[model samples]
Target: MAGMKKLLIALMMAVAAPTHAEVFAKGADIGWLPQMEATGYKFYDSDGKEEDCFRILKDHGINTIRLRTWVHPSNDRASGHNSKDETVAMALRAQRWGMRVMIDFHYSDSWADPQQQRKPAAWEGHDFPQLLDDVYNYTHEVMQALKQAGVTPEWVQVGNETRTGMIYPEGHTDNWPQLAQLINRGYDAIKAVSPSSKVVLHLDRGNDNAWFRTWFDNAQKYGAKYDVIGMSYYPFWLDGRPDYSESISDLGANLNDMAARYDKEVMVVEVGGVDTEPQNTYDMLLAVQRKVADVPGGKGLGVIYWEPQGARSWSHYELSAWGADGRPTKAMEAFRVKLGDK
Candidate 1:
């Protein structure tokens, strides 16, 4: 009777576990692909043949593309350039390429990060309950649109790099219960529109295991339902150095620890390589791949490179590996390389 009861309890526990888990995602944020192509930014293959940006990334073994969506982004010339329409269009192209897609919701009119979590202009002056309704309706609308387009995302981040929280002081960590309520509402909306989509709770500083523990513990305490733990790992610039020799090792350890502690699939949702040291970028990416793939209990989802094609333009994001000829640098070899067991 005791053995039978134990088996029943184990089965019940298994049934209670979260069902969705993100698979290993070799991804890149090519949200700029449409805009770049629109501007005549022709990308070339490694064979020196002109091709579309999506095909080039496909050639490099990228299996997924991450795109960001802002709720009614403004054209105020402040770099808040993304829109839901662009993301939906990008998702269509990624689907055409047989690539999985992840949509990061900024939950703001513009960027929402650790330092700033600005509420959308439309949501301003709303009370907490009204704000929750706004998040739910907006999230549901985005997912519903994707569902209509037949390009529903495989993963949807509730907010982008939301370290402090999302949607300003109302949704910030200072108000944990409110933040949890907002995040939960977003989660409910995503599931309502597309049950297959896995929800991600994203934060910056992937190497900082301590911060992740505190934030997630508080989240669990407040009853936030999420599937994946997405983190940003920008070792080169984020750590105030060009050499990432020591940083990479610490990063790997942190990834492992986060997986073991949280029992949720972890992903480096945003990463980058420096222009000056593309080789270092390659090494760092390779290390991240191997490390994430080695997470305890096989809970690592994978890493996504942030804007690997932003080079040789007026934008001139220094971390991009793209060259003047509109092809990826040698550092992109990281995506193509094979990894052995760690």
Candidate 2:
């Protein structure tokens, strides 16, 4: 009788435990959407009918929206309009559309990437210690504002494409300890406000395993706290302008290796192909999605197309998936097919 009762209890406990549903995130970094709309750019569906950009993105099967926030952004058409207020508003809009949000903190007034990670002008005179405070305070403030607005981001990136490190000389990779300190500060602030949000440490060159290994090895040594590893894969920007075919497999290997090596989740936070070549871009997107989904233990989080809705004519960016007709090209369709679908 005692043994039968114990088995029954165990079965009841198992039945009561919640099951974890695996959701493969289909994301689009439409950070430029607000600026594009503000400047009178309209988005159309495949049928040539004008529609709200969010609706069109949903139709393309985008379940997550990524937005970038800049400190003291200028009013310039191209270089501006990602201020904190703008970010919060966009997050709210995304939530209304039933989409998950990813907050990308550029820590700059403009673009922050591998080529340049300039410090915001407000923190120009701060010493290293003060810089750490700046990161924590700014991150906490943004997170608090989002929380107050009932917007909880699914993922928060502490810095953009920091292969060389962010905040210039102070937080540069040359100074690993200081960079790690800065990253931890941001991480702490984010967790304090939104404990459930996963913090991402992002870098460019998703296909370069050696670079990722070295960089992440140093990050580990310095005790940087991050929940996910984010990467940017842009074959169009490669030195020889290689086709996606040349580097896609390498990207897949790197994603798998990062998950297994680091024991953490991995995501292709940014990826794009030539906008003019929609069919090729479509094929590349499908391949990239497959590579990410193939990560063992389901640690492959998601793939986000950077600025897919930012039509080339408006942004003058060749990597966008939208065309001059204000409609998303066939490449956007790649997102419509989710993982595990036939």
Candidate 3:
């Protein structure tokens, strides 16, 4: 254990103080991938039964687990989404196994992303200030619930895929002030209950530097405070995965620039491309990680491969199902390489 800690510390130091040439090297050691705990479609599973999956992941190197929370889904069920109880159960299970927890707040009943930012059922008629208070109350209650369950989160995301602002219209103040207030409300709520938890402001466009500038600039304009700037990097969906070299340079520059610009840590909170695709996408993902590990800001924390085990066997709550055999998927190999475990 002492040796492992020493190695971890040494790798971090190397990443923090790499030379200019090292920053651009094709085989750089940006940092090791922090082993994470991930649960995708299983999060929405009824009865909240996923002990086997959690155990399997724990046996691996994953030390943290992330679950998403929506408001009120059109479906009147509490599987792995929208319902606070379900999320709490999942967190508790992970906690029981001594795994860290990260809760992703989507701020909508369904999927909240750059495309749409829907309002919650109760806040449909509320005004801007009222909506702000709603956000504060919702965040407080949820975090409080987790605490009562003895599952304090290691990380909390204010909004999910929020390429656009969250709690729409009023809180979505692209003008800065309103947006800052809304963002801070959530941040403050998390801090109030779980002061140790790291709060994140998430966006969808990971590769686009302009989007990062605009969103973070607006958040700052609105006095938005957060510990990390999170992004979703799905090359299959977004700019079509570039070659490993191109991905490394572009993504590394983006991470370095964003960290410097915001003076805050950054993370690829959600990232994955197709593994069973035209084949190129899967290859692209591996190359992307290699490039990131070699880039300057590639050490911007770690990357979370969104739903690699969620093979499409499950629907409605269909997350990605990258798992090929009963074992892990090819994407797992990419993460292994990221950690130098390969």
Highest TM-score: which candidate?
2
Best by lDDT: 2
lDDT for each residue of candidate 2 in 15-125, tens digit (9 for 90 to 100)? 887542257788999888888888899999999999999999999999899999999999898898989999999999999999989999999989999888999999999
RMSD of each: 7.3, 4.3, 8.2
Candidate 1, 74: how far from true, in Å?
2.9
Kindly indicate the candidate among 2 and 3 with the higher lDDT. 2
lDDT of 3 at 290: 53
Error of 2 at 137 (Å): 0.5
Residue 313 deviation, candidate 3, in Å? 2.8
Output the better candidate (2/3) by TM-score. Answer: 2
> Each candidate's lDDT (Cα)?
0.84, 0.93, 0.64
lDDT of 1 by residue, 98-149 (tens): 8989999999877778877889899889999999999999999889888889
